[model samples]
Structures are given as structure tokens and as C-alpha cells.
Target: MKIDWAALGSVFGISLLITVALVALFTLGIVGLSRRERAAAQGDTAAVAVTGAYACFAACAAAVGYGIYLIVA
Candidate 1:
């Protein structure tokens, strides 16, 4: 059997990028929540921070759900 080196490399590249993106997104969510806590301690309204944190979490969840769906289907 012949190995399809180009296809293998392409899949590897895509997977690597997606993994990095997901990790970065999760990290941003954590950082956003941490910033929100700091802002609260300083008595500042963390409206933007709160929104950002939630949005990041939601996106991560959606991505995970979609991956599961793809696997199942």
C-alpha cells in the first residue's frame, strides 16, 4: 500500500491548528473570568469582561458539540 503523504500532512496540519485554537479559546475564557474578579475587587463594573468570558465558554462548548456530532454522524 502506498502512503498518501500529502493528505496525511494536510490532516495533521488542520488538527494541530484546531487543537491550538481550542486551547487558546479556553485560556481566554479563564483569563476573562480572572480579569472580571480583579475588576470586581476594584469596584469596577466588569460588564465587558463578563460578556467576553461567557462568549468564549459558549463558543468552546459549541465547538465540542459539533465535533461530537460529526463523530456520531
Candidate 2:
């Protein structure tokens, strides 16, 4: 049997890129939370930071859900 090396490489590359992007997105969310905490400690409003963090988390969740859907369907 012949193996499709190019297809295998393409999948591997895409997977690695997506994995890194998701991790980075999650990290941004964590950073936003940290900023919010710091702002709160200084008696400042952190509405934007909190909102941004939640948005990041939501996007990450959506991406994961889509991936699962792809696998199942």
C-alpha cells in the first residue's frame, strides 16, 4: 500500500497551527483576567477587560465545539 505523505503533512501542519492558535487565544483570556484583577485592586473599572476576556473564552469554546461537530458529523 502507498502512503499519501503530502496529505499527512498537510493535516499535521494544519493541526499544529490550530493548536497553537487556540492556546494563544486562551492565554490572551488569562491575561485579560489578570488585567481586570489588577484594575479592581486599584479601585478602577474593568468592564472592558472583563468583557474582552469573556469574548476570548467564548471564541475558544466555539472553536472547540465546531471541531467536535466536524469529527462527529
Candidate 3:
């Protein structure tokens, strides 16, 4: 069977895009967590909690996106 270079290229491109997106999202989560920790150390409970929640949400969103990418790709 002949190799389909075009199809391979498309898959590679999509995979790269997904990987970059995931990395960005994970980075956001890490940043959020760092901010939360700093706030907690500063005695701002409310701000710390909010930042923690946002980080959790970001992580969840990244996981969902990865699952969808795997399914479609």
C-alpha cells in the first residue's frame, strides 16, 4: 500500500496543536496554584480559595480537551 503523506502531515499538525494547547493550559494551572499559595501565605484566605478553585477548573478543562482530541484524532 502507498503511504499517504498528506494525511500523515495533517495528523502531525493537529497533534502538535493539541500538545501545545495542553501545555499552555497546564502552565496556567501551575501559575494559578503558585498564586494561591502566595495568597495563603499572606493570610488572604478568600483569594487563596478562589485561586485554588480556578486552578482546579483549568486542570479539568485541560483533561476534557485532551480526551476530545484523542477521540477525534
Candidate 4:
């Protein structure tokens, strides 16, 4: 089968962007979680927003990987 280089490149680029964004968001969530955990331990009122952020990041990252796999295969 002939490979469409342009389309492959576009898919790869999009996947890379998504992966990077997910990682950045996950890192931010981790930082926020650390802060929130500390606050909670100190008996402060910090709602658990980071957990949802982390879950979303995981889903996004998995989707990006799946897209990359589809493009490659």
C-alpha cells in the first residue's frame, strides 16, 4: 500500500501535540494534588479537582496513543 506522507505527518503531529498537552496537564494536576493533599492534611477546604484532571489527562493520553497506533498501522 502506498503511504500518504503528508497525511501521516499530520496525524503524527496532532498525536504529538495531544500527548504533550496531556503530559503537561497531568504534571499540573500532580502539583495541584500535592498542594491540595497538604491543605487537606492541614484541615483546609480544598476540593478534589486534581483527581478529575488526572483522570482526564489519562484518557487524553490514551486516545493520543491510540491515534498514533492507527496512523502507523
Candidate 5:
């Protein structure tokens, strides 16, 4: 059997890109939470930061769910 090198490379590249993007999204969420905590300690409210962090987390969850659905179906 012959290996389809081009198809294999394409899949590898897309997987790597998605992995990096997901990690970055999760990292931003963590940073946002830290910023919110810091602001609260200084007697200030960082509503935007908290909201953005939750949004990031939601996006990550959605992506993961979609991937699972694809595999199961």
C-alpha cells in the first residue's frame, strides 16, 4: 500500500494549529481571571475581565464538544 504523504501532512498541520489556538484561548481565560482577582483586591470591579474570561471558557467547551460529536457520529 502507498502512503498519501500530502494528506497526512495536511492533517498534521491542521491538528497542530488547532491545538495551539485552544491552548492560547485557555491561557487567556486564566489571565483574565487573575486580572479580575487583582482588581477586586484593590477595591475595584473588573466586570469586563470576568465576562471575557467566561466567554473564553465557553468557547473552549464548545470546541471540545463539537470535536466529540464529530468522533461519535
Candidate 6:
């Protein structure tokens, strides 16, 4: 039996980076929402926060969809 150490390591590294990035994005989205709640009392800032949060969420969804597509196709 033969093992491809290099390819295995590459896959592991890529997966780790992607997982970390997604987590960071999600965390940012949560933080943005929290900010929005606080900023609501101050006006326009809440709108910016809401927009940023939604953008982060959208990127996360896109990443998940792309991962699913890669697995299925």
C-alpha cells in the first residue's frame, strides 16, 4: 500500500484555512448585529452595521454552497 503524504497534508491545510475563515466571517456577522442593536439609538450607524452583517452572512452562505457543490460535483 502507498500513501500520498504531500497531497494529504495539502488537503488538511486547505480545509483548516477555509474552516477558520468561515468561522471568522460568522463571528464578524454576529458582532455586526450586536453593534447594530447598540447603534440603533444613535441612528445611521445601525444601518451601516446591518448592511455589514448581512454582507458577511451572504458570504458565509456562498462559501457553504460552494463547498456543497464541490462535494456533489
> By TM-score, who's the top model here?
5
Across 1-73, the per-residue lDDT of candidate 3 in tens digits comes to 9999999999999879977876776676677777777877888755665666587667768678878897999
Ordered list by TM-score, greatest first: 5, 2, 1, 6, 3, 4
Q: Which 10-residue window of candidate 3 scores lowest in summed lDDT? A: 44-53
lDDT (tens digit, per residue) of candidate 4 on 1-73: 8999999999899878876887777777677678778888899955666666577667767877887898899
Please report the TM-score between candidate 6 and the true structure: 0.91
Tens digits of lDDT, candidate 5, 1-73: 9999999999999999999999999999999999999999999999999999999999999999999999999
Backbone clashes counted, model 5: 0
Candidate 6 C-alpha lDDT tens digits along 1-73: 9999999999999999999999999999999999987877667467777888999999999999999999999
User: Against the hidden reference, what TM-scores do the models get?
Assistant: 0.94, 0.96, 0.65, 0.55, 0.97, 0.91
Q: Candidate 3: which stretches are off by over 4 Å? A: 46-73
Q: Which stretches of candidate 1 lie over 4 Å from their true place?
A: none
Instruction: List candidate 6 segments past 4 Å from native.
Output: 41-45
Using alpha carbons, what is the TM-score of model 3?
0.65
lDDT at residue 40 of model 1 (Cα atoms): 88
lDDT of 1 by residue, 1-73 (tens): 9999999999999999999999999999999999989998999988887899899999999999999999999
Q: What lDDT does the true structure give each of the candidates?
A: 0.93, 0.96, 0.76, 0.77, 0.96, 0.92
Candidate 2 residue lDDT tens string, 18-72: 9999999999899999999999899998888889999999999999999999999
What does each candidate score in C-alpha RMSD? 0.8, 0.6, 3.8, 4.2, 0.5, 1.4
Candidate 6 to native Cα RMSD, angstroms: 1.4
